[model samples]
Target chain A: MLKFSKSHEWVKEDAAIATIGITDYAQKQLGDIVFIELPQPGAKLQKSEQLGTIESTKTASELYVPLSGEIVEVNSDLVDNPQWINESPYDKGWLVKLKITNHSELNSLMDESTYRELIAKESH
Target chain B: MESRKTPLYQKHLQNKGRIIDFAGWALPLDYGSMLKEAKQVRLNCGLFDASHMGEIEIKGKGAFKFLQKLTPNDISLIAPGQMQYNLFLNTSGGIIDDFMCYYCDESLLCVVNSSNKDKVVSWLRDNKEQGVELIDKSEETALISIQGPSSSRVIARVFGEKIASLDYMFFTKKEIDHRQVLISRSGYTGEDGFEIYIESKDAPYFWDRLIQEGEGFGLISCGLGSRDILRIEAGYPLYGHEINEETNPYEASLGWAVKSNKDFIAKEEIVGIKNKGLKKIRVGFIMDEKALARQGYGLYLGRNKIGEVCSGTFSPNLNKFIGMAYVLSEYAATGKTIEIQIRKKFYKAKIAKYPFVKINTKSKKEV
Candidate 1:
C-alpha cells in the first residue's frame, strides 16, 4: 500500500526502508518533466522540507520530504532520464530511499484511499 | 483536461497537429517532435497555427494617433503595410505585453499573446478616444506562420513568386484558402518566415494545404514545447518570464525599440530611467554543464547574487542548456562569468551574445 502526503508525495515501506516519489497528480500538474534535481545520498531531511526540484516546460517545483529521514540512496538514473518520473512515478520513478527517522510519523500520512480522496478534492 | 479551442482549432487538428492547451487556448505546440520541427523550419520550412493568439484591428480616422498614445513605440514612423515589434507599458514603465503592430491601410492590426488577450483588448478599449474604433477580430481571423531557410521556396510554391519578394517588416494581400489573405514576412523565431492572416472559416483548409504541399520541403507542425526551446534559443522574450508588469522595457534590453523622439505612454518615466541609466539588463547565457537553469533561479557573480534567470531551456539545436537573465548592468556585457543556482547548487555559466545560434537567410526582396 502506498502512503501519501498532502503535498502529493507517495511512499512505500518495506521493513525499515522506504521508497518515495511524487504522485501522479503532481506529474500531471507539471505537464512534462524535463529535468529533476534529486537529493544527494546521505543527506538528512526533515518532514515537509524541500528535498529536490522538478522542472517542466512552463514551470518548476520543489519536491518536499514527506517525513524525516536520512537519504540512504537516490535514483541517480533520473539525472540522465528524468522522464521516468512521469512515466512510472509509482514504481521505477522512486526518487529516494530513506532510513526512517521516526516510525510514528508514517502513521500521519494518508493511505491510498485517503490520498485518492484528497486528490479528488484538490482537483475541484 | 479542459481544452480551450481557438478560432482555428479544428484546422490545426485536421493538419495532424498534436494539440495542447497553451494559456487556455487549444494550440499545436508541434505536429511532431519539437526538435525535428525546429530544425525543419531552420533547414527547410515549417508552418504554425498562430490563431490562438489575439489580433485586434484599430481603425477609424484617429487610429495612428490613438496607437501613438497607446503604445511605447512611435507609430508615426510605421508606413502602410509595415509592421514593428513593440510593447505596451503601464504607468510605472513595466511591460504590459509585447506585441506586433501591423499598419494595414487606415487600420492597424495588433497581434498579441493568447493569455493577454482580454487584458490587452480592455486596455485599448478603455483608451479609445473619439474617431477611433477598437475591433476584436481574434475570433473571426486565423493566422499561420511558415518559417525556415527554405521558407521563400515554400511560399513561392503556394502563394506565388510574389511572396519571395516581400521585404522584412512588410506584408501584402494575396489569395489563400480561396479567400483574400494577408502574408507578412515576420516571425518570433529568428528565421525567414511568413505569417498569413485569413478568415477563420478558411483557416483549416489553409493549414492543411500548406502542410500537404510543404511536406517535400520538410514542413512539420510544431507545438508550444518546441516553440519555447526555439524562441529561448533565439533569445526572444516571453511575456510572463522575460518581460512582465514589474519589469521595464529598458531593463529587458528593449531600449532599442523605445523611441525617444516622441512622447507616448510612460515615455517620461522611461526617459527618467534611461537618464539614471539602466540598473539591470537582460542577457543571454549558455551553461557549461548539461544541467538546465530554469526561471527564478538566482544568478551569481562569484558568491554575490547578481540576478535571476527569467527563461531557460535545453537547446535541441545546440544540444546544450541556454537561457536569458536580467543581471546587474555592470555584468550585462557578453562573455561575463555568471552562475545559476539550480536546486540550491550553483552551476557555472557565461553571458553570451543574443541568438545562441545565428540563422542565415537571403531576404533582400521588398514587399
Candidate 2:
C-alpha cells in the first residue's frame, strides 16, 4: 500500500522493499519542473531526511525521504529528462527504490484515503 | 496576512487568471503559460491590470520644490504631463522606493509599489511641507499597461491621432470608448507602450475592451509572472531585490539619475558616498550554462563568495538564464568572470552590459 507524508512525499512498500517519489500535489505546486537532483544508489537516508532537490522555472524545493532506508537504485533517466515528474509523477517518475530499514515508520504515514483528504484540505 | 485585492478582482477571475499573493496584493501571476504571455508582449501587445500599485497626489505651491527635497531625481525641469523615473531615499542614502513622478499642472503624481504604499504615505505625511497637501488616490484610480511592439497600433485604434503625437514620458487626457482617460507613453518593458489611468468605475470595461480589440494583434492579458521576466530581460531592477533600504541608488547603477546640483533629501550623504566611491555595484550577467542564478544565490569569484544574486530568470526571449547581482566594484566591470552557486553546483557566468535585449522605441523627449 502507498503511504504519504505531510511534505508531499509518497512511498509504496511491500515486505521490506520500497519505492519513493513526490505526490502529484507537489509537482503542481512546483510548476514546470526543469531540473531534478537525484541521490546515488547505495546512499543511506534517515526518515524525513533530505534526499535531493527539484527546481522549477519559478522556485526550488528539497525532496525528503519518508522513511529510513538504503537506496538500491535511482531513476537516472530523470537526470536527463526531469519533465517526467510533471508528466507522470506517480507511476513513471518514481525517484528511488530502497531496502526498507525501518518498517515501523510506515505506520505513521497517511494511507491513500487519508492522503486524499489531506490533499483536499491543503488545496484550500 | 490577508491578501489585498484590486477593484478588478472579479474581472481577473472571469479571464481565468491564476492569482497569487504578491507584496500583500492578491495579483494574477499568470493565465496559464507565462512564457507564452511574455512572447505575446514582445511580439505583439499585452494588457496588464496594475491598479494595485499606489498612487499619491501632491499639489499646492510647494509641490515640485517639496519633491526636490524628498526624492533623488531632479523634478524642477519636468513640465506638465511629463513623467520621470526617480527614487525615494532614506537619510542613509539608501533607496526607500523606486517610483515614477508625473508632472500634472501644479500637482504631481507619484506611483509606487503596492507593498510600500502605507510606508510611503506616512513618510510623505510626516515630511510634507506646510504649503503642500498630499492625497492618497490609489483607491480612486485604475492603472493599466498596454505594452509591446504592436502596442502603438492598439493605442492608435483607441485614441486615434492623439496617441501618435504623444511623446515618450508624456501624458494627455482624451475621451476614449465613451469615457475620459489619461494615457501616458511610458512602460517598464523595453518596448513602446502606454499606461492608462481611468476612473475606478470604468476599469472593468476599459480592461475588457482593450483585451477584445487587441485580440487580432495577439494581445494577451499578462500577469506578474511575465512582467518580471520582461523587466529582467530589459535589465530593470525591482525595488526590494536591486534597490532596498540597505542598498543605495549609487550601488544600483542609478547614479545617472541623481542630480549633482539639486539639493534633494540625502544629497549630502549621497555626495559623500560618491566621493568615496561605491564599494559594490549591480551588474548584469549571463550564465555560461543553462542553470539559473536566483535571488540570494551566492555569487563567487573562484571559491570566494563575493556577493549574492539580486534578480534572475530564464529569459524565454533569449532562451538562457540571465540575471543581475551586486559584486564588488572591482568585479562590476563588463566581461568580468564570475560564478553562481546554484543548488550546490557552481555555474560559470560572465558580467555583461545590462538590458540584454535592446528595445527599439520611438522617443522624442529626452531624459
Residue-by-residue lDDT tens digits, candidate 2, B35-150: 67887888898889899889999999998888888987888767788899898889999888889998987689999998788899998988988899998999989999999988
The digit string of per-residue lDDT tens for model 1 on A66-109 reads 98999999998987777677788897778999999999999999
Model 2 chain A — which ten-residue stretch has the worst lDDT?
A: A29-38
C-alpha lDDT (0 to 100) for residue B338 of candidate 2: 88
Error of 2 at B316 (Å): 2.1
**Which predicted model would earn the best lDDT?**
2
Regions of candidate 2 where Cα sits further than 4 Å from its true position = A1-23, A41-49, A65-84, A87-115, B343-345, B364-366
Instruction: Please give the distance, in angstroms, between residue B258's alpha carbon in candidate 1 and its true position after superposition.
Output: 1.5
TM-score, one value per model: 0.78, 0.87
Tens digits of per-residue lDDT, candidate 1, B141-165, equal 8888887877877788788888777
> For all the predictions, what are the DockQ values?
0.18, 0.29
True contacts kept of each: 0.15, 0.08
